[model samples]
Target: MKIELRDISISYGKRAVMQSISLTAMPGDVTAIVGPNGCGKTSVLRAIAGLAGYSGQLLFDGRALDRPPKKSNRSLVSYVAQDSAGRSSLTVLEVVLLGRLATLGLRVTEVDKHVVCEVLAELGILHLAQRFLVELSGGQRQLVFIAQALARNPAALLLDEPTSALDIYHQLHVLEVVRRTTQKRGLATVIVLHDLNAAIRYADQVAVLREGHMLACGKPEEIVRPDVVGPVFRVEMVSLPGAGNYPTLVATGPVHGSQGAASPT
Candidate 1:
């Protein structure tokens, strides 16, 4: 499935957090939204997931998304929020089973239970299935939440800082699972990542947002240069050659220094 956001603008009261943003998430690709703290990356994902009100056209699989919270569309797109709220009461297995609720017409069957268990096991959280959400660590809770989202078998996955509270090992683990699952399932995944290196490593396409606008969007190699990154981050970035791999972006100087902007190659 392909997601198209045309001229999307989202506002809170009189303040517009995201303005006239447009982008696409094609199937079997990991598209990342990255920017500074208040750049509205989460708002964009929320709007696309139909959790926030916005003025724009959101199309899924070439069809306009139904505004009334239809089960079809809800099941098609699964959203994993950054905050872990209201989930403390539910056990890991119970939370993951909730993902299949949209598909269960009348009664829960053995197959449904099997699928949920498989997802929990696959995410390496089967041992934590019986534990209460509130009792788990931040990283464990994150994995459970992601497992819940995946149990739905969504066509497009929307995640807001999926690895924010995780340690380095778990961070890489989450990214690896997302990348492998999305590729194997041909699912379109849109994630908001704070870590620039993780975005560069996992994202097939990178979208840079600045002050509520999409400054640039393209392949990682094309869109992640010093010129493109420096202005968005307000930092002096110099790309150093990596050992036979993609170049790395180094913060060479202070952000407020009067360095001449490097022209985009």
Candidate 2:
């Protein structure tokens, strides 16, 4: 499935959060949205998931999304928020099983349970299936949330800071799972990430956002550069050779003025 956003704009009350944004996500690829805080990354995902009201086109499989027909849209897309507070009272398995509600239509069958269990296992959260969501750690809760998103078996998966609150090991683990799932199942995945390293390591394409505007979008190698990253992040970056041809970013403190003082842009 191909997901396209054409001139999309979103607002909260009278404040415009995102303005005239356009992007695309192709099947069997992982696209990472990266930016500083409060740059409308989450708003973009919410618009795509039909959770936020917006003006402009959200095209799924070449058709514009309709408001009242959100169920049909939901069937084709899964959204995993940064926080799991949306349905925390439910047990892990129950929360994961909710993904099947759209297709199952209030009927829960053994097959649904089987699918939930298999997804939990696949995400390495099977042991937490019977546990209350409140009892799990942050990383474990994130795993459960991702398991639920995967249970829906949607063509496109949208994630907001999917690795936030996770430890380094779990962060890598979750991103690896996302990468493998997209490749093996041919699913289109769009994730918002704050960590540039993780985005470069996991995503096939990177989209950099600045103040609700997309500054750059391309392969990791093309987009991950000091010239492009410095202005967006408002910090000077020194590129150093890494394990492969890709380079690592080292903060050279902050940009300085001619007077040898920190210059805040």
Highest lDDT scorer: 1
Clashing pairs in 2: none
Per-residue CA lDDT of model 1 for 66-183, tens digit only, reads 8866777788888998884344788888888888888776877889889999988887889998899888877788878888888988898988998987899989888988898789
Off by over 4 Å in 2: 85-89, 104-107, 256-265
In model 1, pairs of residues that clash are none
Q: How far is candidate 2 from the true structure (C-alpha RMSD, Å)?
A: 3.8
- Give the alpha carbon lDDT tens digit for every residue of 24-44 in model 2: 999999999998899999999
Off by over 4 Å in 1: 85-89, 104-108, 257-265
In angstroms, the error of model 2 at 30 is 0.8
